[model samples]
Target: MFKMKSKSTLLLMLLGAVVGSLGVTSASAEKARIVNTGKHVDNLIHKVDIRNLSYFDTRFDYSSKPYKMSQNRYQTYKLKRSLKIANMNKHKEVILPKGSVVTGLNDGKGNITYISNPSLSLKNQKLVFKTLGNWHGSLPIIKNNGGAQQPYTRNTAFSYKSSAMLPFLSVKSNKPFYDAEGLSLPFVSISADSQLIYHTKGSKYKPTRYAKIKKFKLTHSAITYYLAKPVKGVATKKVRSGKTHLYRATFKMGHVFQMMFADNDTDGYSLTVNNGRQEFFISLYQLGWKYVGSIVGLTGADAVSPTDAKIATDYVQGLY
Candidate 1:
């Protein structure tokens, strides 16, 4: 009976040890699964290293070359004394630090001094200065014997001419004049008494050689002339014989006018008219009739007239 009881106790002890081992193995498996899942989620959502990206290709190349000492006649130097007692009577040799710049040197021996302008980091245990030209780590001294030249006087009388008609016509005129093309005709003239009188240049019976068929004026700006009408007749016809029409009527500032094309597509044109203002631009656009689309404003330096603006737009669209 005693032997059987001892046998039963030993069996129970062995079973407990086996159960504990299996529990430890299950816990380890669970911990490993959690660790692997965390790593996979981090890799899927987070950026590991930005520097490893393919877009970054530029790198700084550190040079390993030594600095050269200046050989100027009036350069500064430091003395190197002899350590041996027998060589104490000999003259001490002068030495200069690496990358020492000789700015202003004196002739006397006691006044010798060296100036070093080194960067934040040193190279080869020596002072390193910023350099230009080749990256071979050589600093070449350049001397300018000739002093700075005197500034040339500018011509104050010279004035820039704008390509716009308004800028050209706004200048003070001594007398009434006509444009070379005869398209710009002075319709009305004011005398010293401020009385308005009809101009003979655009008269129906006695028209000028290049008489304009239509004229445009700023309605809100006290009747200031803007641009002449565009010609529509055949290209072979003469200037006087070609038919001209007013494409844009007299409208106020910021008023857009639509021009219909043969393909049913239309373009818009508007003038930003302002009194006593030297700067102005014409806005053009490609859109449907009565619908304002994307507009591009052309400056006076670009186009001065409706015809010029149309030609510019056509050229940009590769129509030319």
Candidate 2:
């Protein structure tokens, strides 16, 4: 019996070593640093949703009145890229198949992974696209040697969530797109609860404007807000030919939560253990936001649901 037990233990040890080696090899293999190639489509979207436990719903209809843009006389430049980073500690790169579709994923060093693919796999819930490029921008943050302005410091301050507004379709601007002051399209406002939330891409309109989000902090749990002053020139110019949209925007929101009581203004990605897994996230892509893919280190219940991924991919791809 002792001999048999010893042999079994030895076998288990060998198996463990082999598994460990494979895991390490996988990590290194993924580190070759493949990036996004912007040959395909580049786009952005605004995903809005309140934190919930059940599912990601995108259909957002704020019944008051349709939000419109305030006419302004300024240069409006659209973004050339959109990115999202899912903080994951693993080897697997959120693989996107090859095609015309644009993709986004997150990995180490806060890198945005984009895979431009043509055909998606209905069988697998993976984003189908070719391995494109990686993007990095400079923005202020609350971290060490970051931005000095902690705008969301007050408990009542609004949290800016993640959203990218890519003009999917554009019409010729025979006439200048203007508003009241002729300020060149000033702000993008969304109406909610009879209140208007205003945002701009940049302060002064430039030919090409890139608003890099250095840091996002939230305060209170009532309502979050996103504001930016983007340029106005691009909105007047012709978008990409053949392509429907020219620019892409990205939005992300972060806050600290505890118990059923939520605290909006906090610092960093905080995990609250007091409550039953408090969830705080911003959705702007669609009315019924759906999960498509995920990074590693996710536990049970958090496992990537392939069924939902296929449905969303099919639905979005059909639109293009």
lDDT of 1 by residue, 145-188 (tens): 11111111221111101001121111111111121111222232
Model 1: pairs clashing at backbone N, Cα or C within 3 Å: none
lDDT of 2 by residue, 160-257 (tens): 12221211111111112121111222332221111122223212111122222222233222222222332332222223424343222222222221
lDDT measured at residue 50 in model 1 versus the true structure, 0 to 100: 15
Top-TM-score candidate index? 2
Report each candidate's C-alpha RMSD, comma-separated, in the order given: 38.8, 23.7
lDDT of 1: 0.21
